[model samples]
Target chain A: MGESILQLQQIRKSFDNTEVLKGIDLEAAQGEFITLLGASGCGKTTTLRIIAGLELPDSGQVILEGRDITDWEPNRRDVNTVFQNYALFPHMNVADNVGYGLKIRKVPKAEIERKVEQALRLVQLEEYGKRMPDQLSGGQKQRIAIARAVINEPKVLLLDEPLGALDLKLRRQMQLELKRLQKQLGITFIYITHDQEEAINMSDRIGVMHEGVLEQLGTPNEVYYQPRTSYVADFVGNANILHKNGETLAIRSENIRMDGESVCTLDAVVVEKSFAGGQLRILFRLADGQLLTASRYGIDNDIQPGETVKIGWDAKDAVKVIDNDKDENQR
Target chain B: MTKTKTKGNSRRRSGNIGLLIPMYVFTILFVALPILYLFLLSFLQRAQVWGVDFTFTLDNYKRILEPLYLDTFWQSLKLAFTATFFVALIGYPYGYFMARMSAVWKRRMLLLIMIPFWTSALIRLYGWIIVFRSNGVLDKILMGLHLTDQPLKLLYTYPAVVVGMVYSLLPFMILAVYSSAEKLDMSLVEASRDLGASSWTAFWTVSFRLTLPGLLSGVVLSFIPSMGLFFIADILGGNKIVLVGSVIQEQITKGRNQPFAAALSAVLMVLTSVMIRLYRKITGTSQLEGML
Candidate 1:
């Protein structure tokens, strides 16, 4: 939709003899918040590091704002990264840490002070300017890290699981805060995280990775509703995958209705049922002995573990995914 | 049940106290008592062959203020500081390189630093003597190569003494700085660089500041032993450079003034304690608990 601010063409990286990134090609539009989402060791962080110029790709081109910056060092690149640990300077107070970039550029003292105040206020940490990083809580430290990065006003902002260190509630809150900040700043953000919920909640586009390969890249809705591979389907959310010919048909647990009015109805015995907040998660074993999970809301009727129930879903809800074997072969 | 639980707790507390008493007794008997004795000995007059006729006097300390003994103390301090300064300057980069190296390289380089420790300090000083002597390998090679008309008098000099001390104490500095540098999280350095700081700026602002504790300890390690050690100066300095340690040795063996030697030893110990306290204050480090 806009000119590409950052582009990675066929980037490859390895540690020792093990390949970590296998020819990753990705592009981020101006003002886009793209997340590289995957499980651990899936090269999501490696890709983000490559984009930030922290790690050199074996063979690739990194173009930023239409300039080939593949060989640019991290300090030379107009990009800043917020590490998961925050990595705040333990010796420096909040204002000094935030203004470090400006000071490095030899900006005027008054300008640096003004910018630091503005940045601290942006992260709602105006009063924390005199405190050291160790004195701050995890959430406050994360916000300081964000303030430090945003103070630079780089063309691209790389985040390596910036919320991974926070507690669950704090992480959720930071997720909203980060999204809001991204929208307000409109800088291209290349975020890396293993948390699928975080990726789905904050990203304009989610690139799902599996074992150093990009499985699929799309909007969150597309990744959830129209997964291109079995790994993506299982990685993005809970899915009941059934093999049909060479392709795997994946149906979301919530899409499989229990009314038994659909064409593909199977007699299943309820194996387990869990009351999870507003929804009930019912695990079932079909006549073919295949396990399936289904979620139903506001269902007062209780189903015993051994009780037989007819489970069905419309054919339209079953998205076809390439079989694991086929996907591996393609790679 | 409550009585039994209380009894068990009291037994455990007594056991812990029992374990702690021996450590306290050992420390007091071997460490604290000797230091206290030395402090008192410094203020006493010399005894006449263990006759137990003692008088409190500051004569030994006053004698040290004379030019001959005073120069030795000043020289020892200057030499110790010089060695410590060079050790830090060289060791910081070496330690940084070691920290950034791969495991294999790090182990190999650490072994290079440690190999000297396995050998005796005297033997290492002997090795330096042989290398720096008038007709030793270094001089012979230089003369043979026609680099100079005569064999240079390098063996018995202040530079030779400084060089030997630096060689001996450099490993401690490197190891101390290396331990700190190895534990440093690389993300912080990257964060600094990402903020547009140059490599040198990042190193000074973040890397060096974080490793200050190690550097301070290393300085202390190098300074303390170098001050008290007269062997390197005795061997390489040709007995011309009289350090505080040489003065103490002279008072005991050559001068035959045991009480004065004891007084000098006490003064040196006090100086070391003061230096250590100052170092801890500056670096905000507690009394170093781990082996250097």
Candidate 2:
């Protein structure tokens, strides 16, 4: 990350009487990969669209590279977008689609051809230059769309869940590819996605959004180990939230142990057990009717349901988080 | 059990083909037989009375090459070209904009375009007559606006016939362009804009090229029919305009020479097929039939 390159200040938007975004403020440093993470209808996509100049906020300021560009046309802004559906021009071949921005700027034919070839090579689709958009597979189309957007050498690239249409395996491959491309080009990326894993995996900082408000913006470690709010804790990863003595606390599922020396311990019953992804997860219920989950490596088939057990977690692992129930009620 | 089910399906498939017999008969008798008879009549000699003689001759075909008939063909081509030009000019933007509208407005506009089809085209042409006639709706508006002190005598003119042709055939062009325009993905246009192209550039490079098949189909639909709509010329241009259809009608009814009329019709059919072939070559698809 370098100097601040883009900023959104007090952005608010409403559509047909439904407030889609409250006042949102954010800053992105140059060459930074920031992910807006949220579920559907959480205003992440709308925020991306606003930054891309596809949508205008009801009241806000979008500053790009120290310029107030809130009213600038999309073409006039120094930003490009990779749409979710990979909106390639069906009438044009892969080379033409990649070279469209250069052609629009009246770049010489030879230069555009050379740059298009270089861009296609960057995306590892050099031999697909003559193929029409409909002839390409979904993953290939996504790469072409990225090539097309990056060809303009935009200052910032906005991606609206560009890998959402791919399967899980392909999506993981593309996530690594996109991170590599962002680094190789040194272009700032503002990505929007509903998948927290993708956000945590690829982002320099993840902005966890919920109900038109940003819950927290921090590094993946900070967001995971030390979430600022209960919503962020529950939404980011599996957590065992506990409330005691008028205070809210959260502990990672993996932090709780079946039998270990710890700062706090409780006697409980093993209520349920399941194995997934080479890990054994067991649910424990205390006499007070409070449920806690504990995860361990490998399948521990010896632990049967309804058996007596003890659960313990260190005090350092339990982080106090703001209970948003009252805040949500106020809003 | 599966074998018996497949056997029953095969029997039903054969029964389905059997049900199409009336359609085949209707097509052969009404469409195929008339065209065959007309082709045969074109090669036969005209009777001294009111029927074609059985004797074969090439005179009727050669008679179409006469200067008077050639000029009639030229006039027909000219008027049809002009009408198709205006139809595309007005209908393309009308349809493209209509597609960009909201769904409710799109449905309303489609309804507006289709309402004319429920009425007889002749009656609609008559409505135009009331507008184009001297001291009619158009002249009254012009005079009331003080644009002209006297009636413009717009009726019985070439422009009036062109107007009639366009008015009668515009919905075809609009509907054709609308169907393709509605299917065009707007995100592609947005992608173009996102790639540093302006709105106008995006429209020409992406939107226009994508919808071209529809526009060409609309042109063909309007062009082919305008050449044969003799009633439009008869009602609007009075005796001033003479098209190939008017000449064919004259040879059939007034001249009582069915062979010559068949020869004229055969030439018109050849011309239309040539146009359709050219359209197919340009679009590389049989989209003309789809438009029809």
Candidate 3:
């Protein structure tokens, strides 16, 4: 990551007297892929919209490239958004849609045509320029939307769950393409999604949001391994929260071993066993009825549902986390 | 089991066909039969006394080409065009803005637009007479405001007829535009703005283009009816202006020339069909803008 390109300070927003974003402060390094990950209505999209100038923050400053653009109109801002529904102009064909921003700027028609062709080539849809938006499939439309936004090459690109509507396979494919495109363009990308796997796969850093608060912001490995709060731990991945001596600790399910050597060990009965892809997931019930999930690679047919198993993990691997307001995080 | 399923499917298909019987019967009797009778009557001759001669002649069609009747058609076209232009100018923004209003405000506005319809249109036109008549409510208001020196002869004129036409047909224009504008995806505008298009540009390039189908349909609804709403011309114009419908009515009742009336009606029908065909060609869609 290079020097910071965008800064959001003490941002707040409300709708109908309900405060959606409490006070969000974030900084995005130049050319960095940052994602705001949260469940629905967690204000991730609201924050993204604020950054895009689609919504005004009730109180705060949005500084872009050393300029305060808090109250600027969306058209005046040097930022673009890729909406979840891929809001393409149905009246325009793919080429015109891609060239819309340039046309608005009154760029020469020949240059616009060349840039449109280049942008189409960037999205690998060179043959779709003459096709209407309705003629393309969902994936194709999404590519056209991306092409349209990127044709202007704004300083920052904001994506609000752009892949949310696609099938799983197409979504994964888009995630890779988006990451690659962001890297190639070297534009600061502020992405939003409720999908943790997507965030982990694409983002250089992930900001985990909960209940209008950004719980944690870190790299995917740091977030998965060293979550600051129990909420982040539970939301980002499957984790077992164990309270000992008034300190909260989060251990990743994959870190828990079956009859392996470690500093800490616990004996629990196998409550259920299921196969998940290449891994075997076992749900174990502790003596006090606390359920802990453990994932291991390959087959372990010997351990039946009724059998008792020994689970252990190193103390260093169990990162200390803050006990959150919600007690339901322990499960 | 498959045999029973196929049998059930066939039964359902036959039931569906049975349900269409009344629709077919009504279309033939009310729609097709009248057009056929009008076409046949247009080719017949008018007798010296009452009704038609029953003898075939091209005289009625030829009579429509006469300068006196041609001028009536031209005046009707001009009046309808003027009324339609005013209707579109007032209605497009009215309906478009109404669609963007908060739900409560939208419902209230829609109710305000619809409340006039509960009363008869003829009654509404009569109400307009009270406002447009010389030395009446409009004159009193203008005098009270000291905008004019004396009462103006505002009633029973061409402008009064045009106003009545607009007042009566404005709702259809509003409703037509509203139905289509309501379905406009607002995010497309936002997306345009995000892509550096100003608000005006976004509206012109995105919102206006997308809602054009509805505006065109509104024009159709207002224009076609304005030409035929001769009662408005009669009550408001005081028979000073004669439209195609007024001529057709005069031929049928006062002149007792039913075949000539049929010929005039047939010509109006052809004009309406041509307009509809032009509309379909321009819009490239068969569906009219539905009511809200």
Candidate 4:
């Protein structure tokens, strides 16, 4: 692991008395692709914008390469952002858009042209430099946005859902391409996405956010399997937060096996079944009438509604998570 | 591709054409007929006893080429151009403010801009006269404040005409520019700054370029009507300067020279077209300036 190259300390922001990013503390290492994962209005984008100097924190320090830059203007900082909407200049051609930063710095014309060509080639759109943004497809616009940010070669590249507007297949393809580009450039990438699957596929670590605060920050497996709070467990995927003996336990959907050999067996009756693409999801009800859903791969035609099933999971599979929502809601 | 389908398509086409008949009739009767009549009238002679004589002549066109009338045309252009330039300068910031304001303030600002349109233009011109007349509010205020020894002539001047014209036409500029500014993708401005562009450069490259259509529309809308506001010159100008509007008015009303008035109108139309072309070229809005 590399040293921590970017640090956000107690970053706080608000708009008109409504808090957006409430004292967010984050650390990102060099050459690492980290994602800020959360739903809309959860302050993920606000945190990323603050880190890039596009926004000034209400009270905090932003140390970039060990230099405090909290009050620096966005143009004065060595960070770039790929906005959520691509934000390509509709009037300019691709080359001009990609080379805008260098041009503003008054770089030599020949060098600008060469760098623009190199940037376009990096995004696999070498022949598209002469086309206007409106003439390009949605995926193409996203690549141009990436190329525009990459051409600056900033220390940290903030991507605010660059693949958010593309089709599913195209989003998957660009995810891999972006990972490759981040590796090739060795720049720290701070990606913001609301999709859990997307963050898992492309990030070395993901920061989960909710209500203007970071809920947890860890590797994808650690975040998924060892969530620290009930909110994080619920946000990551199907969260089964069970109350046993006045203690909270979080288990993943895939861990709960049906009618198999394991520890912690419970008898429940099948209530509902759904046929998904390759998996059959069965919802079960305990004697106390609590609902539990289990998914098994392929069609298990034998299991029907009203059938009693034995569900079991190993004792080591579940993680103890604090049920903060119940406590906070009571306050 | 099939016979029955083609017949159904033809029937639908005819139905659509029938729906547009009222609009087509209105355009032909009120718009096209007047313009054609103006064109034909410019070539006919104006007789003293019987209104327009049938004899075709180029005398009306030739008379308008004289320096006396040409100077009025030039003066009108000077006023219109200056008013449009200053309007753009002032209205652009207002438009940007309106665009960036919160929803509540945007509606309030838009309502303020539209307040003047509810009043009659002639009434508004008379209101200006109250401030601009000799020893009126402006002169009285200047003397009352000991700013001037004598009541400086405030009305019957070129500046007065421009003031009235701008006051009457400023809303067009603001609304036209506001339309473009409101639809601007604000993320583009943020992206420009993030890409190492200073605030001014970001505005020039992204925000300002994207709003060119609105700016050009403002210029055209403000300018075309300023060319025809003879009433503003009539009241505020007080016969001191014979603008193109006043000259055309004099020919049609007092001089009884319909042919010369028609000829003057044609010249103004041509000039307006030329100026619009120049505006389009300078603003880089020839392709799709009116889209949004």
Candidate 5:
């Protein structure tokens, strides 16, 4: 296990009678890419802001590199944030904007320019130093933001959905670029995003947040295959839960095979069938009115709507969860 | 076919011209003609009786180069510049604070700023007279408090004129800076702090520069009007002071020296945009140093 670079302990924040964050405890190890994954308004961004010292939590402790930095102002923290909107200075040119932090620290003119050029080059934007932020495209702006944060060489770089505004293809490309940057720099990156794919692909481990609480924390495979709570299973992937005798059963859409290839098989009537690019989504109803969704590719099955079929899954693939006990306090 | 194509092009061109006709007519009627007339009047001789003598002469312009008149021009520039500086100094912070305020407070502050604007400006100036003149409200309050034995001469000073100008032109400066400050992305400030810039440094690098456009517009709005608002000097300074606006007013109504007055008006008009450009340059240089 890596040494913990940052630890957030029992962070609780509320705004105008609405508790945005309920007791979030998160940890990011050195050089680890940890993501706070949640939908919008779930306090993921707020948690990131708390770590960056942009927003003070109502009650919490932020320990960075074994030091309690909770009361420190944002500039005193050893962390930088790549804002969701990039927030690049529109008036200043790229070089000025990138070198602003160095200039503020009273670094020499030549040194500031050198570090700025180096950072820009790292983002593959050596020639864009003279361009204003508005002159650059979305992807270019995102890279500039990354370069801006990366140049500081902070202990942890917080990014709040840096690619949310970009198109799908550009976002995917930047995702890989971000991952490469994280590995190349070897600095801890605490990324916050609502997109499950982005969080799963870029982060070494993801912390799933729901209504301000840290629901679960694990690697993508662990969270996806063995979700400790129903929220994690539903949020991370397509999950169909079957409630039986107070013990909830969670089966991943892909895990529940259409044909009788597993030990547990149940006869079901196909209620709905929808084609989704590469896979076919089939909704089935059991004899007891339990709805289950099974995802199969074209070559895997030929299930159609209104067709009666048998859905089966091995016992190992089915994970049981207690929905009521997990969310009683949160609600 | 070629004739029809040419006709089509001409039709489009004519349609565009037709759409612009109202603007051109309004400009010609209200703006261009007055400027041309003013320019023509500046080059002519003042009549002994009334109006202007229709003769080409540099005498009117040459009269403005006199030492006494030149002093007035210098005084006008100084006063206008001072009032503008003060307006900007006070307005930027007020505007910045207002922009950062909550919605309810923002509306309340905006209303408070506009309250004096709703009443007639002439009326407002008169109200200032009631406060500043000897044995007036200010003197009465001071005397009541026993701060002074007599009326402390609050009325007829350079500071009085400046206060009046700032009072009148403050809304323009505040609103202009507010317009820019409100549109600013606050996250940039946070980003600056995250990048290791202190709160003060972030303000200079992010908030100040981002709001420069608004501040400059405020300067233009306040400075240009202050240069021309001679009534402030006349009323507040007890008619002891004379800026370019009063000089122009005196020339037209009392002195019957319209040509020289026209020349001064032309000078002030040209100076307006020039001052804006020069102020922008000065601020620009200051910002460049700050950036370094």
Candidate 6:
């Protein structure tokens, strides 16, 4: 319930007659880390660009700090963006790259140097100030990019999958680093990413987008546990969807337990068992020939493929969604 | 078995050396031999039937150091530099436009640049003459507008020579810069702007610096050929100006002093090599492979 630092009022954008952002209505509270999470081509990056003033929305206004900045140029707007590729200047060393914005603003040289040092230290790259981008590792370059944006001290920081280029381990580490940076800076963060785990880990609130529309917006648990749409449930986490008497029921794979202990059990056969790290994803074919997946934690029991198994979940765990046919009719 | 392998390697090496013999012969005949001949002629007083009295003197070098010939060389250098400066000034923006243009528009622009190249250089020079001569297209149009009573004296001047040289060498500069600009990652510019720099600052700090190699290559392409070229100066300068190239031509054709011309040619070659070496040093690029 903090003041809204950024708002997109019915924003829409299209490219070459193809709509990319149908009508996105989003608001970010001051110092809140909000993530626009969706799959590729879901208008998440477009929305982030619109907020950064890199792309002009077709209709509606982008209000920043309670001011309408729809026509403001990127530099005039009090926002900075970190691109997915890092886009670190290859010709510049890390210090110059981080101090570029300050130099552009004609800040005092001494103050610029001090802020650059502080920014580099925040990203844990104090000694890499002299290294060119090509000489640094991918993670180091990503940190430099973060330093470059954060050094500006903009009102809102826009990140378009900033860690998308890193490998899995580095990406996880940088995700935590970014979260810490956001908390320390206490600035509004408008982040866009296709990675659901990243959104859940870093964001206080998440907006799920699908095909240029903001499908659902809520906290991570709200979006994951109580998705209003099937796309949201499937996109946020693993969900087993079932059509029961025209209502769409989505049950998390982990919620389905071994059959004997539950009151509602369904007869199914284990078709495929995949050992994925600490959990096993068991694929089962129900009696109605519907394929469903159940995630069993820890090392899976010695259940072979083509073996008969009974799986069940409590009826209360099944969250019913508005049927797609009815929703399409409403649209 | 290893001895046999070694023997086979040596045999392959010898075969490769034999294959290189023709390449060496061609280079000696076409390149090295001419340069050696020029060097020998530069030091000779005159040529005899078989050989001269084997007298070594520095008169050819000293003659060029005199005021008249030295003035010509200095003027030529100044003109070449001016032409090269303008070529880069116009070509960078043109090449940038080409690089950022859509595929169809880029092709059209590239064709526009190359249209003049399709005709002969001599024909183009003649066309310029027709345009700039007294009572020519330009003079006629100016007079028709009552801008001047007499035709402007623009047909034969340093500016005319510079214009001709720049017009001739511009395509080379554009093509050189375009090759580099085409490969640049445009996202970097966006990133610069997104990180709080204006478009102008981003262009200078990110885009321009990245395209430095391209600009250097363009300058070299325009400067070197324009330095040694005399036809444009002779045709456009009304034969009143003398450059190193004109001196060489005059010695070979009218002056009938082959040795002096050869010496001047050798000097021009040395000047070109020095410029190239200086460029390589300044840009931190390698000479073996062309600039990237």
> Each model's TM-score?
0.93, 0.94, 0.95, 0.94, 0.93, 0.91
> Comparing candidate 1 with candidate 6, which one achieves the higher lDDT?
1
With candidate 3 superimposed using the best TM-score fit, by how many Å does residue B6's alpha carbon deviate from the native?
Answer: 10
Off-target runs (Cα >4 Å) in candidate 1 are: A287-289, A299-309, B1-17, B48-53, B144-146, B289-292
Q: Which sequence of candidate numbers ranks them by DockQ, best first? A: 3, 4, 2, 1, 5, 6
DockQ of 1: 0.82
Per-candidate clashes come to 0, 0, 0, 0, 0, 0
The TM-score of candidate 5 is: 0.93
Best by TM-score: 3
Instruction: After the best TM-score superposition of candidate 4, give how far the Cα of residue A209 lies from its true spot, in angstroms.
Output: 1.1
Q: List the RMSD of every prediction in angstroms.
A: 2.9, 2.7, 2.5, 3.1, 4.7, 4.0
Count of backbone collisions in candidate 2: 0
Comparing 2 with 3 on DockQ, the higher-scoring candidate is: 3
**Clashing residue pairs in candidate 5 (N, C-alpha, C atoms within 3 angstroms):** none
Residue pairs of candidate 4 with colliding backbone atoms: none
Error of 1 at B176 (Å): 1.6
A159-272, model 5: which lDDT tens digit per residue?
999999999999999999999999999999999899999988998999998878788899999888888788888888768888767678889888887656755468889898
- Residue-level lDDT of model 2, residues A91-189, one tens digit each, is 889999999999999999999999999999999999999999999999999999999999999999999999999999999999999999999999999
The top-ranked prediction according to DockQ is: 3
Which candidate model has the greater DockQ, 2 or 6? 2
Report, for every candidate in turn, its global Cα lDDT versus the true structure.
0.87, 0.91, 0.91, 0.87, 0.87, 0.86
Q: Where is model 2 more than 4 Å wrong at Cα?
A: A260-264, A267-269, A285-292, A329-331, B1-26, B289-292
For model 4, residues A1-331, the per-residue Cα lDDT tens digits are: 7999999999999988999987888899999999999999999988888887787889989999999999999999999999999999888899999999999999999999999999999999999999999999999999999999989999999999888889999999999999999999999999999999999999999999998988899999988888988778878866777777777788776778775676637888999999888988888887767777777788855888998878867777778887866665421
Give a tens-digit lDDT track for model 6, residues B83-117.
Answer: 99999999999997799999999999999998997
Which lDDT tens digits does candidate 2 get at residues B96-188? 889889999999998998899899988988998899888999999999999999998999999999999988888888888888898999888
lDDT, residue B218, model 3? 94
